[model samples]
Target: MTAPMISFEFFPPKTAEGLAKLRETRKQLALLNPKFFSVTFGAGGSTRDRTLETVLEIQSEGHEAAPHISGVSSSGEEIQGLLETYRNKGINRLVVLRGDLPSGEVSAGDFHYANELVSFIRQTTGDWFHIEVAAYPEFHPEARSPSADLMHFKNKIDAGANTAITQYFYNPDAYFRFMDQCQSAGINVPIVPGVMPIYNITQLARFSDVCGADIPRWLRLRLQDYGDDLASLRAFGLDVVTELCQKLLAGGAPGLHFYTLNQAGIISTIASHLNLQGD
Candidate 1:
């Protein structure tokens, strides 16, 4: 089998020091030859300008940069303006989603769902961008049901998404099953597995809880047992995540899209373990 491709996700940094660190991180990870580096938008489009700035920096550094465009607090006209700016900047890819709203914020100010956002981008841009949408292998936390959740995914495809990046998951079976379901539903698009390398036990647990990404009872219990032993925790987590990556790649995953959280150490180590270090 051919080697699986890789990509990475990063959030916009808030400080000059953070930007400097991200530049170093990008320099190191660039050696792995990721297909692109995606910069995430803030919930309710709070970091719209920051996301654009980061993507521009990545592009200026000669890397493919895809910006995440959220719909929660944006209008169709507003998104069109952003798309126009990206097109002018020669950006050709985007991650589109119905991002969340903060407490007391309007649920859907100008766009309520991702499908609407996808449709609007298509109508506005006319194939100028390769759109990437989100998928949930274990099902979205707020989804009504599995089948219903799938319909929501299908809606994005119908609205003109080019591919999908699943929410980060550890269970390879869930991913395979999701692929099977997508096949059965006649939704054929590259659905890359989003891989989140485990580093901080407490942080990981909190994120998983909020996103509804399951941590399986066994792994959960084991991580809890480590207490404050970060070295041992990271070691064990690395082994587990690397094994998971091996299984997914062997099973025909198109690629691995890592949620790097703007750091490089764990991701670099994982890539090395997967023999994806460099040419």
Candidate 2:
């Protein structure tokens, strides 16, 4: 079989030091020859400028870069300005999201759902950008039901999303099952599996809670057992995640999109384990 697509994600840093570190992180990950690097827009469009700067820098480095654009807390005018800015910069890809409202924020702005944003992009820019939308294999926390979540995802695709990148989950079965459902629903676009390299149990738990990604009972307990011994935890976590990636690839996943957390050590190790460099 041909090599599957590989990609990495990073959040824009708010400090000069953080920005310098991300530059190094990107440098190391670039050796992996990722199809593209994605820079996240913060909640409520908080990191709008930073995200744009990061993506443009990545593009200047001679690599493809995708910037996430959230519409939940933005006006139609604001979103249009962003689109035009990216287009002027020669950015041809975007990861569009409904995004999260900032703390204590009310209104859903002009676009309430991701589909609305996707529709807006198509109507405004035609096929200029390759749009990517988020997917939830374990069902979105706010979703009314499994069917409801599926319907929402389909709506995004129908609205002209070119592809999807799912929220990270440790369970391969969840991903395969989601793929089955999507196929049944006639959603054939490539839905790349999101992979989060485990580094800390506490941090993982916090993220899982918010995103509704399940940490399987066995894995959770095992991770917790490691306690403060980070070395053992990392080794075990590496083995487990690598195995999960192996299963997904062997089962026909189109690609792996890693939430690198701005660190390259673990992800680079995982890529080496998978021979992702075609060695």
Candidate 3:
């Protein structure tokens, strides 16, 4: 069997200790030979500098680093400047996103949606970078309907996105259905499945709620049974993610993108389980 391709997602650190942890996480996971890795941008462009810094650091360590860019937070000039900076650093991949509105405020129109950003990037960069866009297996929360959401998704690809990384999900069927819909819509780009291993049930629940990802009752019940036992929780979490991956591959997913949560152990375990260890 062909080895399953993998990538990871990380966030910029907020403190000195957090920065140390981020570096350690990168070092440990880099040994797994991920196809690429991404550093998330903060809401309202709060972590713009740090996001670039982290992306460059990952490249410096000889790994592919794809920085996330929020079109809703950046102007055309700002977006060009960021692209130029990454080009100067020899980084040529980006995960373009239509970021959520800032807390307690409305959008001020830097960008209204990701398709607009995709068009802007293509017009500015002209294939200078490999661009990836976000997909919603359960449909975007802001979308009017699933069909409308998918139409918008297809629009992004037409605008010049080369690949799509889905929102993290537990249900493999959701992903398969999404793939089928994309195929029917004529969006032929790779739709990489985003996998999130539940490190903490409460934390996962909160994130799932915000991101519109459903947490199945079976998994929730298992977490509730494990209660506060970290060791058991982690073991079960690994098993769950492993099974999810297996099902995804069995259903024909091209690759897996892990939300590493700035930690190495869970991702490393999953990679090993998939037999994707580095040389």
Name the best candidate (by TM-score). Answer: 2
What is the per-residue lDDT of model 2 for residues 1-279, given as tens digits with 9 covering 90 to 100? Answer: 778999999999989999899999999999988889999998899999999999999999999999999998899999999999999999999999999999999988999999999999999999999999999999999999999999999999999999999999999999999999999999999999999999999999999999999999999999999999999999999999999999999999988999999999999999999998521
Candidate 2 lowest-lDDT run of ten: 270-279
User: In candidate 3, residue 2 scores what lDDT?
Assistant: 63
Query: Which scores greater on TM-score, model 1 or model 2?
Result: 2
Q: Which parts of model 3 have CA positions greater than 4 angstroms off?
A: 277-279
- lDDT against the true structure, each candidate: 0.92, 0.95, 0.88
Off by over 4 Å in 2: none
The alpha-carbon deviation from the true structure for residue 231 of candidate 1, after best TM-score superposition, in angstroms, is 0.5
TM-score (C-alpha) between model 2 and the true structure: 0.98
lDDT for position 266 in model 3: 87
What TM-score quantifies how close candidate 1 is to the native fold? 0.97
lDDT of 3 at 153: 97
- From the highest TM-score down, the ranking of the candidates is 2, 1, 3
* Candidate 1 lDDT by residue in tens digits, 69-153: 9899787788889999999999999999889997687558788899999998888889989999999999999999999999999
- Give per-residue CA lDDT, model 3, range 35-154, as digits (tens): 898999988787999998889888888899999998775688888898888888888899999887678767645788898988998898799889999999988877899999999999
Worst 10 residues of 1 by lDDT: 270-279
